[model samples]
Structure formats: structure tokens, C-alpha cells
Target chain A: MSIPLTLVLGGARSGKSRYAEGLVTAGPAPWVYVATAQAFDDEMVARIARHRADRADGWQTVEAPLDLAGALDAAPAGATVLVDCLTLWLTNLMLGEHGITAAIEALEAALDRRAAPVVLVANEVGLGIVPDNALARAFRDEAGRLNQRLAARAGRVLFLAAGLPLTLK
Target chain B: MSIPLTLVLGGARSGKSRYAEGLVTAGPAPWVYVATAQAFDDEMVARIARHRADRADGWQTVEAPLDLAGALDAAPAGATVLVDCLTLWLTNLMLGEHGITAAIEALEAALDRRAAPVVLVANEVGLGIVPDNALARAFRDEAGRLNQRLAARAGRVLFLAAGLPLTLK
Candidate 1:
């Protein structure tokens, strides 16, 4: 049987990562955390540190600043995996000038190959006013499209706001 | 009995206005469409015109770019009213250097007195990464606070994505 995939979409500080962690922790211990955030600045460094301190001891984190598919592939079979975020992963790809389409396909293939439950966390970035900068606009558009695609492929989809979860599918 | 109030929150082009219109139109003819959009650019002018053309003939449009509370108070009793958005109204308020707190109080008072069914549309703007500018950051925080306040008072609340509604409350 195919493993269940869940897509958790939320805004910044909307408790998406925490919620996804809870989902992973519900079934078993020793979960794999595929973190995609790159600490380019102090703010991100602080955030990454905070997230690390938030969870319990059973999480084995795999850093995948650009190689998310490969990191997920390295996770053992039947071990629940929580991908802290896809937004930062996408940002990494864009900044690194990697092909987004190909990266997404590889990620999809990796997900298909998984034999354990996987929960993907993503930011819902397109719900706000259009940005003045071209890059911000393009990023929001890409984030929205990515979210819709992942949500469609997932068995369950949830939208979170203000630390509350609302099931979308 | 207090008339039902619904808050429909979504990103740009997420079909929020259409959903709110549906809620108003389900009741009776001659519904009030309280438009808060001001066409400062050609794109906005075209978008406003398109939205007007998209709706049916039963809508009585009211231009309330700043005086939203006053315009809302003018609607007849028992006539369902659809406020196309609060985001643009907030933008107008901020750009005009108006007092946001006082205006929000007036709006809340206006909502409290309404005996007609009301559907409010607002863009969810805090989901993206931290914006580069202070103004955008402030605007998003204000928007988020506004949504939360109005949502608490609303009889029904929905968060929309890709034209799909996820009931939040």
C-alpha cells in the first residue's frame, strides 16, 4: 500500500511546522526531519535554532538546502518524515539558479518511492497584496503554484492560520 | 436576532469576491455591492471594470473607497451586503494617513448595528516571507489583526485557496 502524504500550508508563525511535527509524532518515534532552510542570515539562523529546540529527541534531521530529494531518499523505509518546509527549498533553488521544474519532478518521484508517512509543510504566500518587486511577485506566484500541486498529490491537505488547522482536503 | 455575518478570507484571485457575491445573491435581488477598490492605475481600472462586468445585474454598486462605514450604514435593512474587500480599504486608509484605529472602531460599530446579512472579503496577507520594507510589514500585521478581529465577530469564517473554501470557523 502507498504511504499517506499530507500537505500543511500556512503563513509565517502559523504553527505549520509544529502541527506537522505533531502529525509525525503521533504514529511513532525516531522520525526523519528533512530541513530545507539555509541560514543565509542571522534571522534564519535564529529561526532554525528555535525549531531545533522545539522538538523532542527522537527526530533525526537531514539538512537538504538544495538536495531535498536526495535527503528524503536517504531516510529509512517506514520511518515517518516531516519536511519542515518547501518554501525555503524553493527559494534555495531560485537563488542557486537551479531548474525548479526538474527539482519538483525529482521530489515527486522521491515521494512516490517513500514507504512511510510523509508530511510536507509549506507557506501560503499568495494570499496577500501583490509585491512591488518583480522577484517577490514571481516568488509568491511560484509558491502558490507549488502548494496547489503538492496539495493535489497529498492524501490530506490542511490550511492553517493563527495556530489553528482547517482541513482543505 | 443578530443578522449573520460571514468573513471570506483568501489571497488575490482566489475567488473570494465571487464566493461572497454568491452568499449575498442567494438571498434576494438588489443586493448592495460595497466596492472599496480605487483605480489608481490602468491595471486596477481594468480589474475593477472586469469585476463589475462579471457580476449579475442585480447588484447595486456603492463606491466607498474611504467612508466604508458610512456607506455600509446606508444600506437598507434586510438587504444582503457584500463588501468586495477590506484590504484595499486599509490601503486607502494608510495611504491617506487616516487614523486606522478610529476607522476600525467605526467599522466594528457599523457591523454591530447591521440587521442585514453581511459578507466581508479580505485578503490574507501574512503568509509570505518577511517583506523587505517596513511599510509592507506593518500593513500585513494590521491586516492580520483586522482579519482576526472580524473573524471573531463573524458568524461564519472561511479561508479560500485555489477557489476552494476551507471553513475555519
Candidate 2:
């Protein structure tokens, strides 16, 4: 069967993760949750715990902070896979001083070869004032470019706001 | 005839301002540009100057850092008014220790009573990760709420991305 790829975009606390979870849960069991966030600080630890509590059983969690494309390649065929976010993955790459273009190219290639349906969540962060710092501005620009690329490739694209989803493509 | 109100929302450099200008210029000649930005830094001064140069002739510019409602009220009847942004105005009010709730109420009241058609441009800033600082978190929360309120009142609401307009309402 041809694998379906979906991209979900939203702002902070826009209920995008929950909405993406709903989409995957409605399709198949034995879901794989590819968590891209790392526990760098106490606040992140708490946030991660909250996300963990929000998910029910039947989810196989994989901690793929950097090797997202590899994780997708290893997932079982026909079982739905969800990458909780792309922005966090981007953050991990930037802080790790990894080449962003190469990583994104690998991710796109992996998505192309994946056998199972994959849903990706990302933040829409460029719609605000330019960040006061150069690092932040660069990150926002990268996020915007990344989102555009994913949205173009995904079979479905959604923008979430206030817990509601608007189909973009 | 009753006044028409439009709200154009987008991310940083998403061409929202240019799109908003097109909407106004399509209707009439004498356009009022309500700039809510305060040129505090060199970067901002340059940005403001760029925006000024981008605008065409037959434009009346009003600098309203904090008193947006007053500026709207003082605009000539039956003319077109474009409020460049709301987020900057909100920031001004917050830093100035102005009452947010009262000010929003006054702005909404003014919008309702204005005789001129008003087009507003605002940034959608809540679609990213939770801000690390309390002040930034507060600003994002306030921006989200303000966008919701304005969208509710707007006769036409649009979400712009990649220089394209998506009619939200």
C-alpha cells in the first residue's frame, strides 16, 4: 500500500499535537510516536512528562532527537508513525552544530521511502516580529523554509489554531 | 453606508502589509496609514523608513504608539484607514503600564463607531514553542487573545502565508 504523509502546522499550545494524535489514532493501532524533544531543562522535563501522560497505551515511543529519518526507516510496515514535531528536531540539529540542509534532505528522502503512513507536526513561528537576536531570527527563517518544504511534499497539510484544524492542502 | 473592517494576519515578512495595502488601494485614493510602531532602535528606524518608501502617493500617515482608538476616532469620515499592526500597539500599552482590558474595549468601541473603512494588519505569534521568559509568554498570550477578538469583529478575515491570502471568515 502507498504510505500517506501528513504535515500539521500550528503555533504554541495550538492543540496541534493532540490533533495529530487524533488523526493517527483514528487510522491504526500499535502507533509509533517519534519524540524529537530532549530534556535540556527542568521546564522541558515537566513539559515532556505532561505529553507522556497525555498519550494512552498502544503507542510505541521512540526517542529520535536527531536521527529522525533513520527512525522512520526502522518503523514496521503499515503501522502508522508520527513524528511529534519537526521544529524541535531542527532545534536539536542547530544546537548540535549539524548541517541543517543535509539533515533536511535526508528526512525528505526517508519520507519518500517510508512504507507506513507518517504524520509530522511543526510550528508556524515566522508570523511574528523578527526575533531581537540573530540566532532566533535564523531559527525562525529555517523553520519557515522547513515548513514550506514539508507542506509541499506531504499528501495533506493542516494549520491548527485554538484546537481547530484548517486544511491547507 | 456602514464601514467595512478587514483583518490581515501573517508571520514575519509574509507580505501581510503589502497585501493589506493592495486591499485599501483597490478601493480609494486617499488612504490613511496608522503606524503603531515606535522607532526605538536603529534597526526599527530602517524598517520604518523602508515601509514609508514602499507606500505610494495620496497616503496620510499617523503615528499612534499607544492611543490607537483615538487615532481611529480622529480619522476623517468615509476615508479608508489602515492600522499597520496591533501587536506593537499592545507592546506599547504593556510597557506604558496602560490597562489592557480597558484599552481593548475602547479600541473595539472606536472601531465600531468609525465612519471610515478600516483594514488592520496583525501578527499571529502563538504557533511556536512556549516562550522561555514570562514577559514573552505574556506577550504571546495577549497577542493570541487580541487576534481572536479582532477576528471576531472583522467583516473579512484573512490568513496570509507565502504571499497568498486565505480567507478565514
lDDT by residue for model 1 (B1-169), tens: 3769999998965667877888888898659999999999876888799899989888889999999899889998777889989999999999999999999999989988888889999999886678888999999999999999999999999987745688889
Per-residue error (Å), model 1, residue A89: 0.5
Q: Model 2 compared with the native: what TM-score?
A: 0.60
> Which 10 consecutive positions of candidate 1 chain A have the poorest summed lDDT?
A125-134
Q: Could you tell me every candidate's TM-score relative to the true structure?
A: 0.61, 0.60
What DockQ, between 0 and 1, does each candidate earn? 0.25, 0.18
- Residue pairs whose backbone atoms clash in candidate 2: A11-B127, A11-B128, A12-B126, A12-B127, A12-B128, A126-B12, A127-B11, A127-B12
* Candidate 1 C-alpha error for residue B62, in Å: 19
Q: Which is the leading candidate under DockQ?
A: 1
Per-residue lDDT, model 1, residue B59, is 84
Candidate 2: deviation at residue B106, Å?
24
Best by TM-score: 1
- Model 1 regions lying over 4 Å from their true place: B1-8, B13-122, B125-157
